[model samples]
Every structure is written in C-alpha cells, then in structure tokens.
Target: MTAASRGILRVVDSDAAEAERNADARSESQSAKDTAQLVELSKSGDREAFDRLVRVTHRDAYALALRLTGNAEDARDVVQDAYLRAYKGIDRFRGDAQFSTWLYRIVANCSNTHLSRRQRQRHDTLSIHTELIDTRPEHDPALQGDRAELRVRLDEAIRKLPERLRSVVVLRDVYDLPHEAIAAELGISVTAAKVRLHRARRRLREQVLPMPGEVPRP
Candidate 1:
C-alpha cells in the first residue's frame, strides 16, 4: 500500500478501537448508575422511581408473561397483577438480588398462580376448551390461509411442552433472560436451569425438525 493509504488505515483502526472502548465504558457506567439509583430510590419508598423501573422493565416482563400464558390478554393481566404485588411488597425487598431478579420472581409467582386457578376452573367446567378456542382471533382473508395454519401448528407445539421445560425455554429463549437470572427467578440451581433449558430446546427441535424419511419442504 502507498504511505498515505497506510496512514489512513492506521487512523481508521485507532478511531474504531477508541469508539469501542468508549462504548464499553459507557455501558458499564450506565449499569452502575441504574443499579445504585434503583436500590436507593426503592429503599427510600420513592414511587416514581419504582414507576421508572416498571417502564424500563415492563417489555421484558410482559414478553415473559406472554410466553408463559400463551395468550396476550392473560399475559397482560399477569404482568399487572405482578406489578401490583411488587408495589405492595417493595419494602420487604431485601436487595439480596438485582431488582430485576426480584421482579422476575414476582412475575413468575403471579403467572403460576393464574395458571393454577385456570386449571382448577377448567376442571370444574366442561366448556373450558370452548372458551379458550373462542378467544382466538379470526384470520383475515387478505393474508394467505397458510399463515393462520402455521400459527396454529406453532401454538400446539408450545402447548405440548412440559411445565418446567416450558418455563425455562420461555424465559431463556423467548424472553432472552440469562441462565443465572432464570435460575434465580425460578428458585432452582443454575445447573438445573441449564439442564432444563437444554431439554426444552431439544424437545422443541424434535417437534420442529422433520424425522427420517420426512424431508422438510421449502
């Protein structure tokens, strides 16, 4: 390369390196600030600070609830219920874990309670399946019919998953929670969380992938 070209390349590389370092530093600083401020505000009974926390964490919380409940309305209800409980119990928060971690625990507990109540109600009524199927949206005629068909297939696959495996897979894959956070939320050991997640993924693969003699069509 010419001397001028070499000089330009060196400058570009140095600039890129500096930019990456700055980004890393900024990320660390933001993390520290969020943690410190949240802890202080929560301890001081600052409702607005807690509201800010909700605004930041709500999307992830809702997504996790959606995956667990497998329905938008139920998920919304679960998240709302969880947040209410959290608000009432904030003073009891010991700060032993990250605030998000504590929130996840509340979310999980709320979802579980909702699901248990649903199961009990279903057992008492013969019309439970009718009610669930009735809640599903009608497909629009503008879309290809296959889109609706595929959605039904995917929902069935998820519904077939065992509870423990489903929870891990939903939290890890669907909500993108870290394994450690998932374990803490679920009150399981990290190794157990990993194993459950592995099994859940394997089961999902088996359901999605074609078996021998069943070639997947494009």
Candidate 2:
C-alpha cells in the first residue's frame, strides 16, 4: 500500500468510528426521553404506558433480582414486589434520573430486604438448634455456641457490605454465577464486577477472620 493510500484509509476508519459513537449517543438520548415520557404518563394514571415500560425493562429487573436472590422463585417474588412498589410510588419518582435506573435501584433494595428475611429465618433455626443442644447431654454446648457466634459474625459482615459489593459477592460466591452473568445482571462490565467481588471478599475476611496470632472470641 502506498503511504497516501494508507493515510486515506486511516482517515476513513476514524470517521466511521466517530459516526458510530455519535449514533449510539443519539439512540441513548432518545431512549431516555421516551422513558421519561412514559413515566409522566404513568404518573398521570396511564396504565397502558406503565405496562409498556414494564415490558421494556422487566428482563433487566428480573436479572438484577436473580443475581441478588440466587433463586428463580425468590427472584420472581422480588421482581413482583419491586413492580408493585414502583407502581405505588410512581409519583415519588422525580425526573432526576432515568426511569430504568430508578426502577433497578428499587429491585436491588427489595432483594436486600428479601435476603435479610431469609437470613433471619436461618438465624432463628440456629437458635432452635442451640436450645435443643441445651437439653442434649451428649452435645457440646461450648462448640455449638462458638459455631453460632461465628455464623452471626459472618452474617453481620455480609450485611454491612455496600450494596454493590454485596450483590457481587452473593452472585459470585453464594450463587456461583459466572463473571459474565454477574456483569450482565448488575449492568457492569465483567472486570468491574470481578473487582467488586474482590473488594467485597477482602472486606468480609477482614471482618470475619481472626488476625494471625490473635485468639478468636469464645
């Protein structure tokens, strides 16, 4: 290829890339405008518009719930709960953000509540087991107490995590979701998801694990 031909080809490639980016930006802007219009209609008692918005955003919302809950059943329940809450609180959704962003945050918060309730149920079961151990002559009360305390600490650590980090940890460690799936569900790049998981695990270990040469609490 001649130098002049190569220079011309490079200019053409740059123009094409710039045009594609401009197109994407315009598309996103249009989508946001359409969503805002729907939000306005729904707030004014337009059920069909709201339903249309639901159809457009449901897949991403469900994906968010599934990653957090780690169960299809619970994900479905969370999504339902989220939509109901969104419907009732539609008036509270000021146009400060995109409708989808507001909606996804609702899903995340609902999933957090659901997970908390499930955790509490497990804690209650452990309490029952501890009570049973009190009556069993052969059971080691001290060992059981230690186990229960450790679990409580671990749960507290997980609960204390920021929502973004907590979601990654639950999806990656608890649910065994792949990095790509986690990324898709959380609307992040795979690298960002993996980084969040790393940070989350480190925070958890710092809270849950005993330091070297330090004795664990009894």
Candidate 3:
C-alpha cells in the first residue's frame, strides 16, 4: 500500500477502537445509573425492584463482608444482616451517597459486631477460613490452603488490636466511614476517632506489614 493510504488506514483503525471503548464506557455508566434508580424504587417499597437490586449487588456486598470479617461464613451472615438492615432502614438512607455505599456501611456495622464477638468465638476462626477457602471460586485451587492461612494471620493481626482502636479502624478505613460519623457511632469526639484510627494503623503496619508471606487481605 502507498505510505499515505497506510497511514490513513491506521488512523481510521485507531479512531474506531477509541469509539468502541467510549461506547463500552457509556454502556457501563448507563447500567450503573439504572441500578441507582432501582435502589430508589426499592426504597419506595417496590419489592421486585429491591429483588433486582439484590441480584445486582449481592456479590459485591458479600465481598465487602468477606473483606471485613475474614471468614466466609461470617461474611455470609454479615451480608445477609446488612441487606436486612438496609431494607428496614431504606427510608433513612438519604440520597447523599451511592446505594452501594449505604450497603457497605450496613455490612461494616455487622462486621464490627462479629469481629468484637470473635474474641468469644467457640470455634477456631482459622479452621473456618480454611474450609471456606477450599470452596471459594476466586482462589486458585492449588493456592487455597496457603491463602487461607494468610487470611487467618490477618484475622490474628486485627484481633490483636484493642477493641476501641479496632472498631475505629474498621469503620473508618474498612467501611470508609468518615471520622465524624465514626465519632457519632462510637460516641466519641471526631478528634478521638482520628486518634484511634491513627493508632490502629500504626499498630497494624508495625505488626502485619512485616509478615513473611502474603496474607489474604480484606
């Protein structure tokens, strides 16, 4: 082909690829918007709309719970509780944040309850995680055993944290609650929330960061 003709063909190919990407991005954006509308409808007492919302968001909600609780069983429970709480509190959910964010907050609260009770847990957390990893679809089958150990180690690290510090860290960083909100939740000053979060991070960094192997993180 002539040099100019070849160059023109390359530009056209590039433009076509760019347009395709843009179209795909727009499609994703529109899907997200539709989901948001479904959330609103669910809030307004539409049962089918809420069911569609669950179908769209349940996986993500479970992931959020898994990350927060570090045990699949606990994660499942947390996710279920979160959805129930979300449904009951739907009217209280102002339009300030994304519906997913609201769900995350509920999951986080549920996780905190579980995490705190973990101290008194009857069964071994590590063993539960091991069994869970064995069945998890996301992990490589070969690496599941090793990854479960890592997750246990992480749970150990978090468990080592003081309850006050742990609560703040989980709420602020894990669940992405603001300091002010955390303060309100914990009945502390915002300054106290910030201090506890800082303390929690420092301890986790010093303790968990230097661990020899990769730990399955939340």
Better by lDDT, candidate 3 or 2? 2
Q: After superposition, how far is residue 109 of candidate 3 from its true place, in Å?
A: 1.7
Query: Could you report the Cα RMSD, in angstroms, for every candidate shown?
Result: 8.6, 14.2, 8.2
Strongest candidate by lDDT: 2
For all candidates in order, the CA lDDT equals 0.72, 0.74, 0.72
Tens-digit per-residue lDDT, 1-218, candidate 1: 99999999999999999999999999977975896587579668998888887888899789778778777898999999999998889888887767776777788778877877887776423223322321112422223347766566555555666556778887778656788877876678999999999987776554443343332221
Better-scoring candidate (TM-score), 1 or 2: 1
lDDT of 3 by residue, 1-218 (tens): 99999999999999999999999999989988998898789878998998898899999899767666656898898888888888888889887887877777677677777766875776443433322222233433333346676666556666656666767787777678778777765567999989989988876654444333434333
Model 2 steric clash pairs? none
**Candidate 3: stretches off by over 4 Å:** 1-25, 117-171, 185-188, 207-218
Q: Which regions of candidate 2 are displaced past 4 Å?
A: 122-165, 168-218
> What ordering of candidates by TM-score runs from best to worst?
1, 3, 2
lDDT of candidate 2 at residue 4, scale 0 to 100 = 100
Q: Estimate each model's TM-score.
A: 0.62, 0.58, 0.61
Write down the worst ten-residue block by lDDT for model 2: 125-134
